[model samples]
Target: MESTEWHLTSFVNLAVLTFLFLCSQGQVNGDCPADGRTWVPFGQSCYYFVHGNEDRFKSYTIEKAKEMCKDYGLLTVRSAEENSFIVENSLQVWKGGNNNMWLGMYYNSDDDEFKWNDESHVTFKNWEEGDAEDPEMPLIDTCVILHAASGKWENVSCSEQPQHGVVCETPQIRLQRKNASPLLSALVVISVIMILGISAAVWFLQQRKGSGSTLFPSFEYHPPFRAPSADQTCLVEAEEIDETS
Candidate 1:
């Protein structure tokens, strides 16, 4: 029973070490960047909502929003789920102004279709019913915006009035731990545990027996001269006398 407990403890230690290693690699912690923007993580992407609470945040045009976004593109709503996520983050908590916000999608007059600025294929959409569907059609400069009040999308000129605050989008980035290392350390730990287990077993067995007793008491060695049996004695004076007679 004690031996079983020792193995269980070893495995538990291994799992804890593995979890810590993964956390250090950002595989477990999910630590996002702190760029003074409110970033919400969903699926594999991260969305930034403009709440105007940060000193760096302000209202900007679509192009300017793209510029301020750094490596992140403008907000792109792909699915109703994603659209709802954006709405929950942006419109529900919007404090910027009455104007609408920009999306990564734009009307491409050449293809006569709306497409994402990031060039990801449009697999889903959450267009507001009725007039919101038409951006006056075939206009190359037409762009999409999130309607502030209704929490839906709207069509407008890329540089039109009612410009909005910047809501950037970027893949989540995690900080690398400078002191993190690999699994070789775990192997060393296992070696130490094994040595400890062997020592513990030896101690347990020694305690079960009395003091001055070896682990295998039957195999204890002693000098032949110290033996009490005549057969084991080194000197035999009676046998020597009989041989001379």
Candidate 2:
């Protein structure tokens, strides 16, 4: 029974020690970004596709689409990966047979440059043949659209074209609760280890007391002088009597 308890205690101590070590090392928990309101997670951002007649109006222009996406996130493409993700997931976003949607790209005739709605740098482009140009009327097609059928881009007049849907995107959020300072985490870990150590020490002492065991057993010491036996006493008396005689 004592051996069983000892083994169980050893296992508990080992587990506690392992937990302490892991805590001290500050291992981060595997927490992914949350996808809310049916938004899809791709890479480091969350994407939302607005389509169907449920919340959409009869006609939605680029400016109206931008207003709708304002509450969700900015209406723009951040990278080529994001653009590809949008293309692949286009059908899933809107299944009402519409193949074209508004992107965040717009051409500015003032600077003679195409830029995103958020005014970010345009590092990637996926324009189709003859897109983003007007041979007869230059600077007429300013807004961009993702052509689902061709999986490419085409520029249309922002005010002239009516879109069936819009794609909104924003960066993924990191959980703030898990981001503790290293010193605070270390202090918490050390406190837990100390508490476990103290509890184990007390338990060990209690077990030793109940088992009547000592770390170093001491022996009782006796004097060399001992009381004489009956025979020895009689012999001593007789010798004393003879001497007296």
Candidate 3:
């Protein structure tokens, strides 16, 4: 019965630990700024579209678009889902105008590789057949743009080209609600209290157990030896003399 109870207690503690861990994870999240810009949430990051002319779909060169998103870096599509999302938003934002937009990727003819403007590694990619089939273009033809009709990337010359909007991606951010601090603090304190209380109760119960196992090590106690005082010694000698007489 004791063993069963102990196992049950262990299970309860494990469950509580798991719950608190999950709560902590949920408390911290990927959130963009509360600024006026409409930041669309994509896996672990936020995105904003900047065409500069919201009244009408206007296009900007790579340099101009970069300037427009000067506060934030140019869009770097890391995955297919992110690429698709950007294309969809561009179609909505640009409407009648050409939906082609500038990306952060640029061909590095020296390294014979493509690189993002922010220097992030190129892991996942979605490129059109023309881009992959064609031999590497010259360094001047390094810039990349997302084809609106099809969600694929295309290499284009960095020279004067048709106007295209730019997208901005913010740095990694963690979200915490202004009013949620006190609630989270209370939960943490309560969790700690519960764990300590359970531990103390378990200790007390173990100590109270009348088992052969001792709570503390046992040891023998011996009284210290002492020499007789002068009066006691004299009395002992007198008694001995009377006995001898």
Local accuracy by lDDT, each model: 0.67, 0.68, 0.75
Ranking by lDDT: 3, 2, 1
> What range of 10 consecutive residues in model 3 has the weakest lDDT sum?
50-59
Task: Locate the minimum summed-lDDT window of 10 residues in model 1.
Answer: 22-31
TM-score-superior candidate, 2 or 3: 3
Clashing pairs in 2: none
Measure candidate 2: CA RMSD: 9.4
For candidate 2, report its TM-score.
Answer: 0.56
lDDT-better candidate, 2 vs 3: 3
Q: lDDT tens digits, residues 170-235, model 1? A: 776655545445566566556666766776676576565635676665765886775468764535
Rank ordering of all candidates by TM-score, starting from the highest = 3, 1, 2
Candidate whose TM-score is highest: 3
Model 3, residue 213: what's the lDDT?
66
- lDDT tens digits, residues 1-245, model 3? 57546756875786787577657655755678788887888787788876455545566888887887777788888888888888887778667455777888877667677888776678888888768435665654768888777888887778746567678887658766344466776787687678767776776667557465667768899989999999999999999999999
